[model samples]
Each structure stands twice: as C-alpha cells, then as structure tokens.
Target: MTKAQIGLIGLGTMGSNLALNIAEKGHAVAVYNRTASKTGAFFENAADLRERIVPCATLAEFVAQIRPPRPVVLMVQAGKAVDEQIAALREHLEAGDMIIDAGNANFRDTIRRFGELEGSGLTFVGMGVSGGEEGARHGPSIMVGGAQEAWRQIEPILTDIAARFQGEPCAAWLGEGGAGHFVKTIHNGIEYADMQMIAEIYGLLRDGAGLSAGEMATIFQRWNSGPLESYLVEITAEVLRASDGATGGPLVDAILDRAGQKGTGRWAAVEAQLMGIPATTIETAVAARSLSAERDLRLKAQGAYADALPTGRLVADEAFIRDLEHALLAAKLAAYAQGFAVMEEASTEFRWDLPLGTVARIWRAGCIIRSQFLSEIAAAYDQAREPAHLLLMPAFVDTMTMASPALRRVVARGVEAGLPVPALAAALTWFDAFRQGRGTANLIQGQRDFFGAHGFERVDAQGDHHGAWSK
Candidate 1:
C-alpha cells in the first residue's frame, strides 16, 4: 500500500478535526494517539474517509506510515506533553522528518525547542492554528513559522485546510522560529480585550440602561449586521438569546460571572511589557480576568461599598444607543491597533521580518478576531507607504476622528453610571496618548532623575540631561 502523505499525533478535538480536514482535502493522513483506544475510535468514526486515514497504535507504526521527508503535526498540550511526544517521535523518525507543533505554546518555549532540534538533521515547525474546533474541522487560520524550505514542503496541505477570505487562503508562512506562536499570543490578547469590551457594553445595557437579556440580544444582533459584524458579536447575540432549559430564564444569567483563561493573554501582556510596548487594552483585559476570578472577594467588596456606590443610571435612548455602537467600534479599532503594533515590534526584536499584512489578511477569516475591520488593516499595510503605526494610517485617522467623540461620551457616561469599563477606558486613554505631540511623561522623567539619578532626554538639547533636584 502507498504510505500516507502526512501524519498527525493527538486525536483530541482539534487534532481529529484537522485530520478530517486534511483527508477531506484529498490527502491520506496517518493519525495516532497515546491512548490506543482513541486511535481506534477515531479511525472507526472516519466513515467514508477511513480509506484516507492510517490509524497507528504505536510510535514506530506511526512514523513508518508516512513517507520520507515526512511532515507530522503534534496537536497535543502546550508544555511538557509536547516535549514528551516530540522525544518519543524522535526515537522512531528519520533525519529529514519535520515536527510541526500546532499548539498554543509560549513563543519562548518554541524558540528553545528550535535550539534543541538544531543540527539534529530534523526540521521543526511551530504553527499556530486558530478558530477552535469548528474551524479545525472545516478551515482554520494557519500561521506557520519555520525554515522557509520546510514551509514550502508543508504549504500545500496547510493552505488546503485553511479558511479562505474571498479567494485567498488564510494560511501563510509568517516567519522563522517562534513568530507564529508569538502572533497567536497577540491574537488571543486582542480576543480577550474584544470580549471584555463586549462584556462591558453588556453590563452598561444590563445595569446602567436596565435592558433585558432579550433586548441586549436584539441589540447585538443588529450590531452584527453593521460595521461591528464579526464571529464574536454573532456568538454574543446567540448566547444572550439562549434560554436556560432548567430555569426557563436567560441562559447567560444562569452562567457564572467568572471567566477562565489559558495564559495566552497574560503571555501577550508580558511580552509587550518586556518590549516596552503599550498594550494597555490587552493588559487591562488580562487584569479583568484575574479580577473576575476573585468572585468571593468581589462579592464582599460589593456588599461593603453598596451604600457608597453610585446609583446613576444611563438612558438607553436612540441617540445613546447609536453612541454605544460607535463607541464599541472605536475601542475595538484601538485594541487591534495595539495588537498589530506589538506584533510589529516583536518582528523587529526577533528579526523575524513578519509580514504584517499577511497576518491581518489571515485574521480576516478563520481566526477568533476575524472582522471586516481586519480587511481595512490589511489594506493599510498594502499601501505604498505603510504608516509607522496602524493608527497613523490616513484611513484609520479619519475613522478615529469621526468615532472618538462617541467613545468618549459612552465611557464618560458609563463611568458616571458606575459601570466597569476598563478595556474601553484603556483603549480611549491609549488613543489619547498616541495622538498627543507632548505628553506628561516629563514629570515622570524628572521624578526618576531626582530620586534614581536616571538620565532624561532633553527636548532642547541633543543629549540626556539631569534635573537640578539637589537644591
């Protein structure tokens, strides 16, 4: 029998779906799972595609099923599990076989993995797969980072399995080393900010405006048809509109307020801080998640401050509702601008030469943050003279100018209504700082110079100068 074209380890949700996707695209795939029963079950469930799936129970059998110059995808857990699988696979694989880690791994770990695999006559690819299980079974956005030559070998299969925006595939070779995972981290960071901003808007409508869950659903549905249209907004409406079967109430009301995270958002914030980039909205979103986890403490604090808390409520009239929509759009733009900026700086820092436009284009379809807004970002980068920053682009400048007042009004009103809008507020503040010609950082520099003797850059002079603080 002819050997399989490629192999995948891990028969979990993501891996199984991706395997089926590859098979559907007409490639024979060899699949394996450490749990031998899972391998059997996956093969049994392949149905008509069974002919295209080579299910292997052992590492030796898995490696043997794929032809030489083989490319194998490992969709296992992000950390040590991945290391263990790679180690096991190395024992049975030949020199030229490539290992593609398709997990939400820290870029630092990915970089280290590259070092460990170097000079071993084996190729390694760190790929970021997004869009969740549904996208995996159908088409997810794929970001591949590895040797350009190794990328060429796996490009066809990835492109075939990736979601398409218009006629273009949402899969691309981003850069070398950990660039793909780094980009995915920023994607999740932006996703956290986007979700937090949406939740803030929901709180404003629910608490401030006294809207019912059904009413909020209608509003979100309406937004989905407009400029704010995206997968997340669409799902937000779906979630709000759902009913709890057990209680006959809004399903969302039954769900706990606490949100859980898998650390990608925190990694994004950490990397930004390390690079001295201002990802304020992302940072605020991560902080919000941590705060959300303190449910008991929050309850106690709320009770303690109940009497002193503001009782002001917002009037969700036609004009105010329109402002909310624009406000969301404006804040989302700022968050995305910050995410892309972080990616740009990371690209420079790692010497990855990441194709920023391709990143935006891929995100326009299969990723969690997929939006029409990303198309505008892709266009911004495609211009002959790409702006130094995303917000500096001429088109974005016009957008920000037009929508900023709405954002300001919404944030100010939400604050008065005692609504927590940290992500939105952070976006506004970041935008304000970005547009300012001269900021208040001079005082901070002076303070640092006074106490720590840290040098400050002089506006008038060419060199660093010290403030006369001894007196």
Candidate 2:
C-alpha cells in the first residue's frame, strides 16, 4: 500500500477546506480531528475528496499513513492547544518528520516551539496561512518559516496550493523561526489601521458631509477603480450597498458601531513599542478599536457634551469629495509606511533575513489587505535592497505632495466637527514627523535631561551631557 503525500490534523473550517484543497490538487491526504465526528462529517460532505483522503481515526493512525520524513500540518487553536497537540503527536511520530503549524500564533510562541524541537530530530514549521475560509478552500498566501530542511521538503506542496499572482505563487519561505507569523501579525496590524481609516472616512462622509449609506457605497466603488483598489475597499462598497432584508435599509446602518479584534493587531503594536519603532498609525488603530468598545461610555459622554458641541458640516461638492479621496489615499500610504518600518526593525532586532520585497509580493493577493498599491511597494523594495523610507520613494513622495493637502484639510475639519479621526490623523502626523528635518524632540530631550539627568546628545558635540535648567 502506498503512503499518503501529507497528513492534516484538525477538521475545522480552515483545516477541512485546506484538506479538501490539497486533495483537489490530486495529492493524497490523511486527515484527522480531535472529535472523530468532524472527520466523519468532513468525508460525508466532501464526496469528491473521498477518494483522495485517508481518514484516520486516531493520532497514531494519522502519523502512520504518511511516508518517511512525513509532513503533518496542525491547524489547532493557538496557545495551549498547540502545545498539547505537539506533545501528543511527538509520542507517535518518527525522527526527522515535520510538523507544520498553520494557525494565527504569536511569533514569540513559535520561536519557543522551534527551540523545543531543535535537537529532537523533528522539524517544526510555523506557517501563516491567510485569506480566510474562502482562501483556504481555494488558495491562500502561505508564509513559511521554520526549519530550512523542513521548508525544502514541503515547499513544493505549499507552493502548489497557494494563490497565484500573475502566474507566481503567493507562497514563500520568509525566514527562519517564526518570521512568517511575525509578518502575518504585522499584516493584521496594517489591516486594523486600514480599516479604522476607512471607518473614519465613512464617519466623515456621513456626519460631516451628510452622505447617505448608498452614496458612500458609490464613492467607495469609484475609489476601487483608482489607486485605492483593494479587497477592503471592494468589500466596503459591498457592505455599504447591502440592505437589511427585513428593515429595507442599508445593512451598515443597522449594524453596531463596535469592532471586535483578535490579539494579532495588539501584539504588533506592543512589539513595535518594545523595539522602539514608531508605529503610531497601527497604535492609533488599536486605540480606535478600544474606544469603539466603550459604546455606552461614548454615548454618555456624547450626551454630556451634546449641548456645547458645535454644529459644523463639510462641503459635499465634487471638489471636496475628490479631496477626501486624495486624503484617504495619502493616509493609507502613511499607514503602510509605518507597518513595513516595524517589519524592518523587527527583522534587524531578531536577526531574521526577511525579504521585504517578497513580503509585499505575497501580500498582493490572497490576503485581507490585498491592494493595487502593494505592487508599488514591491517595486520600491525591488529597486533598492531597503529603501531609506517608503515615503521618500519618488512615487510615494509625489503622492504625499499631491494628497497631503487634502489629508490636512480633512483632519482639520474632523477636529472642528467633533469627529474622532484617530487613524487618519495619526497617519498625517507620522508623515509630517518623518519629513521634518528638525523636530521638536530637542525640547523633549532637554526636558528629559532636566527632570531626571538622563543626559542629551548635542548636534555640534559628540558627548551626551546633562542640562542644568535651575542655574
């Protein structure tokens, strides 16, 4: 009897779809689930995949079905469940076999796991599989990071199953030891920032410009045809256009304003702070989500200030609308600049030789943040091993020069109108700070030295000296 090509553990939506996707590619799959019923149900519903899959009743049976140096993917929940599964699988697997973890795991946890299996003769892989349920069923952008030997063995299979961009696979070996997941986490962070900016724009249009949901949908649709074309923008158009079947109104109008998040975005922000990288856009995005969660508090606060708030509205003419679009594009570029900067900092700090260009290429498709703008990013990194800064790139500099005026105007209008535009405002501020040759930080350093004798570096001299302000 011949052995299956690979094995998959867990039969949840992602796991099951991935299994079927593999099987559909004409590869034999051995699948198992913690609950045997899920395995049974998977096979029952997926009749087309029946012939290609080897359903295993137990963990030992699953491991036994694969060939030597076998690769088994674990799609279990992140954290403790991952540890438990690894421990259980280790008892039955042979030396030199590979374990692929295809879950949204914290990168630090992945590094620890890789360390644990270093001398055990088993290869451990932490892969970031993005594109959600549909992408898993068809093709996802697969970010592989772990043992190099293990990656070489599984690269063919991974590349075959990933989404394609202009005939290129969206799968790539990012780096060693958790680099894939780290990139994915940062990807989510950028996503959070992108979304918050979009939401803020929606608020600006609705409250400031008095555009209805349908009108906003049309605007988003138009934006999707321009440089802002992206999965998020496309989806925003669909979301805005959707109707509440029962209420006969736009679906977005009925939905709650609160936004929920998993931990990836927060982790990205926290990691940035730890590394001393300024990821203000991502941080503001996380802050926006937290603020949104305080719905009742916001309502009470709004009521308290309702009487004193100024009544101001933005112009809804074509000139103003065009300005809003330019502002959004500029802010979005700033957000990406901050996100990739964090990646660059982490790559240096962690000693991971991350290919920033490849990261941009893989993200072009089969990711939540897929956009037309990413190709420009890929081009920028491709031109220079590492550009001094994304904004300094000629294309981005031109965009900023043209669009920043609008961003400034929009932000100013939001402030005067009592609308919170944290992400957008943060993006503009970051851009401004980045372009500043001489920042107000000299005052900050002086104050720090005065208060705590921390010391400050001089522009003219080499030594760090403390300032005595009292004298």
Clashes of each: 0, 0
Residue-wise lDDT of candidate 1 within 252-347, one digit each (tens)?
A: 999999999999999999999999999999999999999999999999999999998899989889999899999999999999989988999999
Best by lDDT: 1
Positional deviation of residue 2's Cα in model 2 after best superposition, in angstroms: 3.8
Candidate 2, residues 236-337: lDDT per residue as tens digits?
999999999989999998999999998999999999999998999999999999989999999999999989887998878898889789989999999899
TM-score of each: 0.98, 0.97
Number of the top TM-score candidate: 1
* Model 1 steric clash pairs: none
Question: Which segments of model 1 are wrong by more than 4 Å?
Answer: 384-387
Check candidate 2 and list the clashing pairs: none
